[model samples]
Target: MRNVTDRIFQGAISVFIRKGLQATTQEVAKEAGVAEVTLYRRYSTKENLFITVIKNVLEKKFDSHVLEIAKENETEVFLMNIIEDRLEILSKNYDLVKMLLSESLRGNLANEINLPDIIFSSLKKGLEYHFELKNQTVDIDFCARQLGGIFLSYVVLPNAQPFNKLTLQEKKDIARKHAKAVLATI
Candidate 1:
């Protein structure tokens, strides 16, 4: 039941992100290939269903991966991937991201999810992974959000421009430099 619910919700995130929550349950159910009744059966209401979808994606994609990567030995490399690799992940889900951002600005607060907690969580994980040595000390959460905010901005950019407005190699090169700047605070 949970797996089915999660799958439906993940699909919902894609649909909702693409079409906005003003998008009907029927459309989402169609995207999910589940009956509309099935979504209502699992979620009870549109708001509840949207929340479920947001929370699940938040945990599975955004939170977990950041935590896992923060544990890596090479913090620089790990951070670079967070900055760059995650952008690739965004490319695959660009439409959804586009919808989410637009919806947020249009007075759909109920449709929103927690931002600071998510940012703080990723930062904490990154810090834990990067600064385990006894002699080193760093404010992991602050730096994470600072740098993470920068990356997040890049993610939600118009997508009309490539990451660097150039080839893949150029984006990676820029990301590498950005990652270094992010690390400089640590």
Candidate 2:
């Protein structure tokens, strides 16, 4: 059952990335090697399936990492982990991210699946958790916006060297630099 659902999600992602919100359930069913009825039976509608797939993807690819990193003792380490993990995930899923962003901008997706909002919320929650653990208070909203801005900038702006193409060490270096600056601010 889980395997079948995974296949459907993967198929949905592939089709959605290629065709954005215009893709059909029939296409997704074909891609997943499942009958069209299977998709409808499970998700009921294309919009529901899209929302499920995207939420699952974001939780798996981004949110879980943030939650885990929020447990770090040091703010700098937490910032570094969040920055590095998010940049890598966002860079690797660049196409899907861009498609979602475009659809979001066009008002085609639900607010629950809005990529930027989710990212910002996840970052904000992670920061709040970290600070609460330390019994420290800071401008969590401002810090989340700053971090979210950095992530979104990478999505829409061109970089000299694409993040995915950079070596692990290079990625770490970038994360460290950004972490230091963010730490200084908050």
Candidate 3:
């Protein structure tokens, strides 16, 4: 059962990134090597499956790690770690990010599935928790927005080499630089 769900999620991700919201359940099912009826029975509709797949991806890829890092590190170290980790993940999943962003810009995705909102909110939550634990008071909303902007700029802006293609030192340098700038500002 878990294997089938994993296959379906993987297939949904591929097809959704390729076709955006226009992707059909049949294509997803075919990509997953499952019957169309199976997908329909499980998801009820393409939108349901899309939302589920996206939430699963975000939860699995982004949220948990950010919270964990927040709990375990100081402010600067947390910022650098989150930035580097997110850059690598976003770079590797560039196509999916682009697709989701494009769809979002076109007002095709639901409010709950708004990718930018979700990312920034997750960052805000992490920052808030970290600051609270340390009894440090900062403009958490601004910080979260700044961090989100940094992440989105890397994803949307043109670069000579993608984040995933950069050497380890280069990645760390980039993260360090951005983290310092953010700290300096706030």
Give the number of the best model, judged by lDDT.
2
1 or 2: which has the higher lDDT?
2
User: What is candidate 1's lDDT per residue for 27-138, written digit by digit as tens?
Assistant: 8888777899998888888878887777666556556566566656676777776776556555555565566667667867462465436545765766666677333577
The model with the greatest TM-score is 3
Tens digits of lDDT, candidate 3, 1-186: 459999999999999999999999989999998999999899899999999999889766777667788885578888888898888989998999999999988998877687877787778888888888788899998898888889989988999999999999999999999999999988
Report the lDDT of model 2 for residue 185.
92
Candidate 1 global lDDT? 0.68
| TM-score of each model, paired residue for residue | 0.76, 0.92, 0.94
lDDT of all predictions, in order shown?
Answer: 0.68, 0.89, 0.88
Query: Each candidate's root-mean-square deviation in Å?
Result: 3.6, 1.7, 1.6
lDDT of 2 by residue, 119-180 (tens): 88788888999999989989999898888878888899999987989998999999999899
User: Which parts of model 1 have CA positions greater than 4 angstroms off?
Assistant: 1-7, 133-135, 158-171
Give the candidate order by descending lDDT: 2, 3, 1
In candidate 2, the residue pairs with backbone N, CA or C atoms under 3 Å apart (3 or more residues apart, or in different chains) clash, namely: none
Evaluate model 3: give its TM-score.
0.94
- Model 3 stretches with alpha carbons more than 4 Å out: none
